[model samples]
Target chain A: MMRNLFERTGEKTLGFLQRLGRASIFLFHVLKGFPIVLTRPKLLLDSLYSVGVLSLLIIVFSALFVGMVISLLGYVTLVDFGAEQSLGVLVALSILRELAPVLTALLYSGRAGSALTAEIGLMKATEQLASIEMMAIDPIRRVITPRFVAGIIAVPLLTLMFMVVGIYSGYLIGHGWLGVDEGSFWAQMQSKVQWNYDILNGLLKGFIFGIAVNWIALFEGYDAVPTSEGVARATTRSVVYSALIVLALDFILTSIMFVEV
Target chain B: MTQAYIEIKDLTFARGQRQIFDGINLEIPQGAITAVMGPSGCGKTTLLRHIGGQLQADSGSVSVAGVQMNGLSRSELFALRKQMGMLFQSGALLTDLNVFENVAFPVREHYQFDESMVRDIVLMKLEIVGLRGAAQLMPSELSGGMARRVALARAIVLDPALMMYDEPFTGLDPITLGNIVTLIRSLSKSLGITSILVSHDINESLSIADYLCVLAEGKVVAQGPVEVVKATASPWLKQFLTGSTEGPVDFHYPATSRANDFHLEAKS
Candidate 1:
């Protein structure tokens, strides 16, 4: 039993290493094709519309609800210590530093990331990729690099938008709804939330998460087995892998930025 | 026979354990239609991939227009590919683009042609395939045969010297099938382009092909002019040509015997 277990584990480890090697090569090709994609601006713009603009509604709605809930929780907790005025700091810091970038990435993975996987997977299954190859056009440059650039551009932008909307909704709850002192709330938030320490770090995290999520998504699609079921599985894996990578990268980035090492 | 435009010699390839092609040799004459017919899972499509330089041979070489496909650089292979065109079985049109844009794709990819020139070339190719009127329709809106015609239009848009049709007649209605067969014949003759058609549609292919090759068990079973293919003495070839189930070709995949699998005793 122990031998079988070790054998299976070893095989799995080898498979994973093989996949990692392939993904690294795919990334290299995508980066190499980046300049070629720039010459075709319309491809990038279309990808932005799909990956970023279309995802606006869900991001805004989720941000508002999350912001309100965080404010409510923070107010109730702080009221016990007569520090209810600090509700703004709690909500603003959480949204700007943690919630905005992480939640935006998770949602982006579910929405744009899965869609990208499905689209590219279907393209492969239907032999569109092969057709492009037969035409002597590299599908990586023609198809993948534009979407990668667009995702990197979109995720950070979406994270920033999420932060703004989340903070605004937090203000609405803390001052307008919960009846906290509006002047003290704004003052505390402004004093507490350092631009470089919190906001810039969050955007930096978003940037890294953007690269991770898009890389996972595109690689999954490109490496997918060419079939209907393969595409479906690839789409699922894209979202799941993106979510995991986003969360894991969040922890590492947070430790590096916020922790006193 | 004319000088060979595409040559395959001692080519062998495998996917993991199962060898798909074993020492297969072929010579496709310049500016003639060569139909490669084989059973399902018999590597007809794999042969096309070899000829197109998408898949490399294990033991031998594939040469297209005198250029060895194996060791050429990516740019060189791509440059070679520009002189070749392949119509995939699924039509494989870019779903996002309309038929006009799909047909214009190859031209637009290679050259900075004026819109008028692109449109003129695209429309002219579409007219040949009788899809000029359907240019504005999306791939999703197209019928299977319409999509195939559009793919063919795209394949020929660059005026390639070599054209490959991979199962060009599969999944088409008889009328559509006839149209495609006619198109394949006329295009090869009119443009004087060498053609390699990989298909199982024996009658349709034989109707259009000048030369015929029948592949079985990773080897060419029979190959000659269309006239001689009908009178081959090989029982395997005869059975295949006639579409008979009773032949050397097994109806079932290799597996345990039914009685053994079900644990039934043999009848005395």
Candidate 2:
């Protein structure tokens, strides 16, 4: 019984390590071949149009609601302290420093990341990738690299858009509706939210989240067993794994970027 | 004997606990049509994959032309693959691309040719398969035979020296099956390409094949010229060729007796 337990544990550990090694190699290939995308701008643009442009509705709607919720939450708390005037700083900092990057990444992982995994997984299952290899074209350079570059570009840009729409919507709800002073709201936000400290760090988070999400996506797809069930499982795994890793890394990056600031 | 165009020596392969190929050896003659025919579960498709370098043997040397498949680097293997073409059972055309682009895929990716050159070559190849009119059609729109023909067109568009077809006649109607068999034989003659076909369509295969190989239970049971195979008297080979399940091939599944397993009284 003890020996069997040891064997099972060892097998599980070996499997996990093998997966990690394969994922690392896949990530290295994506980074190494990333420059190839410059010659193939159309692929990246198409992906951006898919991953970024198509997610616009959800991002805008979510940002608006999230911004209003933050305003409401901040307003309730500030009423206790008699500092409702600080709602501008509260909403601005929350959106720029945290919500924009993290929430945008979560949405992108659910939407674009899942689709990328499914598409590539299906291609692998169908032997289209193998056919590409047989034709002397590198599937990594031809397929995944463009998509990876696009994800990196699109995610950050989408975060910026999210931040913009979100902060303004917060302005409407906090000041336009709740009767926080319009002057004090603008004044407090400008005074408190430093560009380098909040905005740049948030964009950086967006960029890193983009890379992590796509890396997980492409890895899951490439590593998926060539079957319908395998592809389906990998698609779900990509979303779940990408979301968890993005959130986890957001904490680490937030500590490194913001804790110091 | 002259060196074969493709050779496999001491090839052994297994999937999990199931042995697919056991120290198998094969030599495909140059510029000939060779058909590998066997019972349904025999490793015919697996053999083609080993030759294609899609699967590696547990212990063997698979040489294509002069290149040893396992010894080749990733890039080298791909370079070797460029000299070969494979038609899968389902056609395996990229669903995203239309039929013309599917045929044009290999040529366009490999060479820096202009669109016109691609169009001409693609049209010419499609014309051979009688699918030129179906160029703009999606793979989803293609009939099974049409899809296979389009795949054949894609396989040949690069004009590779070797072509592998997996069950080209398995699900085809009689007319389409006849058409595909004729196409394979005619194309082999015209292109002078060595062809390895995996199928169980005995009449069709034997009709077109210069050489025939039969695999059973992870080993080559018989292989020779079509006339020699036709003359052979092995019971295993005869039962297979004659499609008689009552012979060596057990009609009963391998299992404990039904009475013992189900705890039932035996029928008188």
Candidate 3:
């Protein structure tokens, strides 16, 4: 049993190494296709539409609900402590620092990232990549680069939307519904929130999350074994990895930014 | 004799531990159709991959139009590939792109021609494949044969010197296959382009192939002009051509085989 366990561990390690190698190869192709992003503006624009415009409703709804719930909870607790005015500040910081970008990434990973992986995975399975190479169209440029660029551009914009809807919903809950004065809410926000730092951190998290989601999705799609089961596995793996990496990076960034010295 | 447009010398390929091709030497003469036919897993697709530079040979060289394909950079290979076109088995048309965009893909990717030029060329190529009216339709909207024609149109859009078709007749109705075979012949003749077809459709391939190569067990079991290959006395070739189950190609499972064991277990 011990020997079997060690052998299983060794096999798992080798599998991870193989995946890492395939990821690097895919990354090379993606970087090589950067010129395509500039040249194929239509493809990039269409991808932006798919990744951003299509995702707007879901991101907005998720943010609104999350922010509303958090603010409502915070208001109840703070009112009991006679510190109800801190709800605005608490909601703003939560949305900007954590909820907006991470949750938005999770949603993007499920919708856009999984779709991207499935699309590319099917292409790979069907030998479209080989066909592209035969036609002298670099698959990296023609297929991956546009999607990558679109993801990078779209994720941040989606995160911005998430932050906006989240803050608006939080304000609605804390001020209009809960009867906290609008003056104290804005004052609390102004006193506690640093726009530059908060926005920068949000954007940074958005950018990193975008890269992680795209990289994982593209890598899974590109290296997917050419079978129905392989495609299913790749799609699942892309979503799971993207979500995990987004949450992990959120924690790392938060710790670096807010941890007490 | 016309110069051989694509010359593959001693080409060998291995996928993981499996050797797909070994010391396979073949040449595609300019302005003719050369067909590589074999049973499934006999490395016909791998050979096409080598010729298209999609798969690097384990050993040997692939030279296309006097350009050595072995050491060429990806960009250089891309340039060579731009001069060639490939039709995949499933047609491999991008589902997201409409027929017009799929046909226009190559022209737009490699060249800096204006939209009008690209549009004119795309339309011309589509017309050649008799798919001009189907330009706006998505690949999913087209029938299998129509999709293959669109793929062929996309392949030839750039006016490539060499066109490679991988299993062009697979899964097509008889009428569609006949049309495709005629298209393969006429396109190569009309454009003065070299064509290489890798297929399992032996009879159709024999009818269209100026030169025929039969591969088995990673080696060419028979090769030459169609008549010569037809006249050859190889048991594998005979069995394959006649679709016979009684010869060297065995379909029956042995009693002691793992497949047999699995079947018995499933039955029980």
Highest TM-score scorer: 1
For candidate 1, give the docking quality class from DockQ: high
**Candidate 2 lDDT, tens digit per residue, B1-268?**
2348988888999999999988788888999999998888889998888888878889988898977888678788888888888888888889988999899888877789998988999999999989889999999999999999999999989889999999899889999988899999988999898999999888888888999888988888887787888798498788888888778779888999898889898669
Off by over 4 Å in 3: B1-3, B257-268
DockQ class, candidate 3: high
Tens-digit lDDT string for candidate 1 (B1-268): 7899988899999999999999998899999999999889999999999888899889899999999999989999999999999999999999999999999998998999999999999999999999899999999999999999999999999999999999998899999999999999999999899999999888888878999998988998888787887776488888888899998878899998888889898679
CAPRI-style class, candidate 2:
medium
lDDT of each: 0.93, 0.89, 0.86
As for DockQ, the candidate ahead, 1 or 2, is 1
Which residue pairs clash in candidate 2? none
Question: Per-candidate TM-score, first chain only?
Answer: 0.98, 0.96, 0.96
Which candidate model has the greater TM-score, 1 or 3? 1
Give the poorly placed runs of model 2, Cα more than 4 Å off.
Answer: A1-6, B1-3, B262-268
Q: For all the predictions, what are the DockQ values?
A: 0.88, 0.61, 0.80
Q: State the lDDT of candidate 3 residue by residue for B37-81, as single tens digits.
A: 887899988887777777788898989899888888987888788
lDDT of 1 by residue, A1-261 (tens): 999999999999999999999999999999999986668799899999999999999999999999999999999999999999999999999998899999999999999999999999999999999999999999998999999999999999999999999999999998898999999999999999999999999999999999999999999999999999999999999998899889988999989999996
Per-residue lDDT of model 2, residues A120-188, tens digit only: 999999888877766667889888888888888989999999999999998899988899999998899
